[model samples]
Target: MDVFHVTDKDGNKITNEKVIDYIQQSLGTNACLLPSLRRTVGVKAASKHTAIELTGTDRPGLLSEVFAVLTDLKCNVVGAEVWTHNMRVASVVYVTDDSTGAPVDNPERLSMIKVQLCNVLKGDNDKRVAKTVVSTGVTHTERRLHQMMFADRDYERVHNGLLESRDDKFRPLVTLQNCVEKGYSVINIKSKDRSKLLFDTVCTLTDMQYVVFHGTVDSDGPDAFQEYYIRHMDGCPVNSEAERQRIIHCLEAAIERRVSEGLRLELCSGDRTGFLSDVTRIFRENGLSVTRAEVSTRADKAVGVFYVTDAAGNPVHAKTIEAVRGEIGQTILQVKESYSKSPSEETGGRFSFGNILKSTSERFLYNLGLTKSLP
Candidate 1:
């Protein structure tokens, strides 16, 4: 391996040890998590990178779900590792912004990201009896009551012939200690461990533009522990006690609401041309954003997993989910003998940066209040 040495004007040889220390001190904070160590949301304590870890009970469809959340949050996955041992799953991922490809730095934004992830984990909790009552075709009022309980974690339903649910013994927690003299912020996170929890937290931080330098993570059943040494974009440790408190508060609240709402829709239809386009049209017309999607075909059947939210980026309300499903059922039935070809469809063959820009621009416009009813 070749080594590059730092030099002064006189070309004095600088000890490599001093340079390595500066690199660790000045480079972004940790991005990966080690068991029994700290916890965090996103990567390197630097501006454009971060290191992170997530651990939870392992299950089928876990990896895909994590990516789905990342796609929904608009975080770009640059590198990742997925491993499962015994009944637990651990993932280490490096993420960046979808648009700017930079670290996420805004606090309010990062909090929301972690919260969404926690909700995903909530959906995976074995003790939760409701388990998305809205998806089970229950009464509107009943669903409402149950969802509230989920969000508040105050109600429990019976499983089997006995009451099998219990309150969360471990409340969610997130903390960051500024180690500026050492040049990093130590971030710790404790929440319900679930699949993709790591990605969601890390992606959130990436969106906020913070970086991770060093991190460690471990899980015991449903509770997860993580630690991260981080830095801000300007390479400074968090200096305010108020700021630290705010960080803790936001993560606590975010974890509470993570899976208390939102709908995960699965659709299976007879395959035909242009089906995806029609589905997306339904999403746009109904003010839905397809946060994540997986589509596949087996024999004559087409199956898809859709992680969705309203245009405002909150979970799709119960009323809206119902209405959208009804519309989707009708649209799939109206599938054409062949896919409806469009201008872009015909132009397919290679990736186009222009098309990417156009799509992003459309979302930006919509976020600024675009409407189908608009002229």
Candidate 2:
């Protein structure tokens, strides 16, 4: 928790000095730090569906850009803690935004948004200077518990069973397609059959809810895989974590059951990169067996719905739609509801699942550290 502090000409304590310092350093100044010097700042923001907490080195004018990114994501800042010590500064920012939570189940999509925010800090749009990603995937048992939690049922406490089910893990995609309003006919083809055809189909399908007016694609195969995008809205789903998880599980079950039938063209889009590999590893890591899989992808993003039957797939849940949705379904629902309330809002940039991640590159940021230094 760090921030910058300042004073007016009259000598009255103005803003926190560290927050100002961090802002200056982030603007391309030397943010190098000494061992003993540390600055801390804490920011707390809460909306109906999301929360943000940011902490790091202290500098000047940092709040402006931080707020800008939040503004861009339409996040509301609720609280903050700022501090600095010996030229070092740190801040913890709290925010809540359902839009950022739109594709919470898609790893690449979530990673991309975070990476974009980090890039805004690094002062670079170029691919080279991107930020890294730190993630914690969930387990299948965890996902199931999450589903139960957000189920909107009377027995709200059962969601806590996730702790006992700590061993069940899975990597499954869960697409929340409400076909009730928007009647998309593209369900006739496999996601891999026609990339553009399937994408347009999925976008239109979500649009049926009327809550989703904007959509984009992020998969490498514009001609092969499925499309992943975020829908913007005003409010968020319920604030209950239990309800959130339950809804996710339901969505995952629904999407997986729908697509696996082969009759459902909703194939997991994106490329066949390390995503499948990671899913497999998680399955193996948790002692789960991947009985079978219809895996495919077109870019760095990928989709591999495995018929996994064990804990090995648990941690990989984050990589799969099941886990993401299971963990944060209520928030996603809120975003949908918010959009439904205001049908007149302006649309932002549209992206595919892969483009969203590629737009920011948060997933690749960590890999960049292992990469050779640029010339």
Candidate with the greatest lDDT versus the true structure: 1
Which digits, one per residue and each the tens of the lDDT, describe model 1 over residues 65-165? Answer: 56667667776555444333223334444466667767655566556556665565445464432121101111121112222222332222223355533
Residues 1-375 of candidate 2: C-alpha lDDT, one tens digit per residue: 111122332224436556456545644545432121111111212232222223332233333455555555554433222222211222333343434432233445445546655655445322223234342222121122122222212122233344212212221333343232233211111132111232234423332231322233233333222323222243232234554454344333322211211110112434321233333333344444432223323344333233333332222332443453333242321112111000111111211122222223323322434212322
Task: Quote the lDDT for 61 in model 2.
Answer: 38
Q: How does model 2 fare in lDDT?
A: 0.30
Least lDDT summed over 10 consecutive residues: which range in candidate 2?
Answer: 337-346
TM-score of 1: 0.32
Each prediction's RMSD over C-alphas, in Å, is: 22.6, 26.8
TM-score, one value per model? 0.32, 0.21
Give the runs in model 1 whose Cα sits over 4 Å from its true position: 1-172, 179-183, 206-209, 233-235, 241-263, 273-302, 307-375
Whole-model lDDT, candidate 1? 0.46
How far is 182's C-alpha from truth in model 2 (Å)? 76
lDDT of each: 0.46, 0.30
Q: How many backbone clashes does candidate 1 have?
A: 46
